[model samples]
Target: MLTHLWRWTLFSYRAIWQIDIRARDPLHAARRAWDIQRDPDSPATVFDIIDEFGTTFRVDLAEDNPHLDAQPILATPPMPAWMARLLPRRFRRHRIRSRP
Candidate 1:
């Protein structure tokens, strides 16, 4: 059996994320770690994010854990026009194309 886990910390203006995946059978921890590094957001895994105020949020796909069923917030962060210009042209085009 293999399982994935993640722990996150939030600082004043930065976020630190760490992930660990291990097996209960024959696979070595190193191999399990490699699998997790390849795709941190793969299906059937859990993701967690914590804020500075000690608020913990979790999204689990495992049957033994609780599930989150809330609607997503559709607001975008405010960015300066000049700062947006620093991104690659293709990324900017994709962002603009995705907007309604």
Candidate 2:
């Protein structure tokens, strides 16, 4: 019997998204937003993303955490003992706080 190696891969997809960008004018803002989306480190995900184009992407401004309303902010693991020792006591342990 042979064992198969498991791995995860990330795929890119095209979707319409609106982003609030601060710039001198509307055109500049749109350009800035486009640059951000083009960056490799952008946080955009393809999950539930549609391939259809020319469709409007509507978002309810009133709803916070619209897609992750039920998800809780998990606490981050503490820094290693050796790493913590190099920093001040206040910065040793860090935890992510939930929005009110």
Candidate 3:
């Protein structure tokens, strides 16, 4: 119980920190990490940002997007544990059968 509480506390702290950073300048951070850009001339309906590690993130800020709420920003094909382990810790949690 104590160990689980500790892990949850650490995760919450990290998440809150990220939220604070994003609150300051979300678009800049997004662009720096994933190369996503919002153009005044022609803003992309779906922002695609690819990280240096080749991870693609799709961002949909439009409220009309049908799957906007439910869709995972970085959905992955169902993969086995061994394959999923190769992914980042943040992504591994979304894996079909990922184990911490």
State every prediction's TM-score relative to the real structure.
Answer: 0.28, 0.31, 0.22
Task: For residues 37-71, write the lDDT of model 3, one tens digit per residue.
Answer: 33453333454543333344555555465352343
The clash numbers for all candidates, in the given order, read 0, 0, 0
lDDT of 2 by residue, 1-100 (tens): 1233323533332334666677999899988987887888775433233212212233333355455223322333334456567777786556321121
The lDDT values for all models are 0.48, 0.47, 0.45
How would the candidate models be sorted by lDDT, starting from the highest?
1, 2, 3
- Candidate 3 lDDT score relative to the true structure: 0.45
Which candidate do you rate higher for TM-score, 1 or 3? Answer: 1
lDDT of 2: 0.47
- List CA RMSD, all candidates: 15.7, 16.8, 13.0
Clashing pairs in 1: none
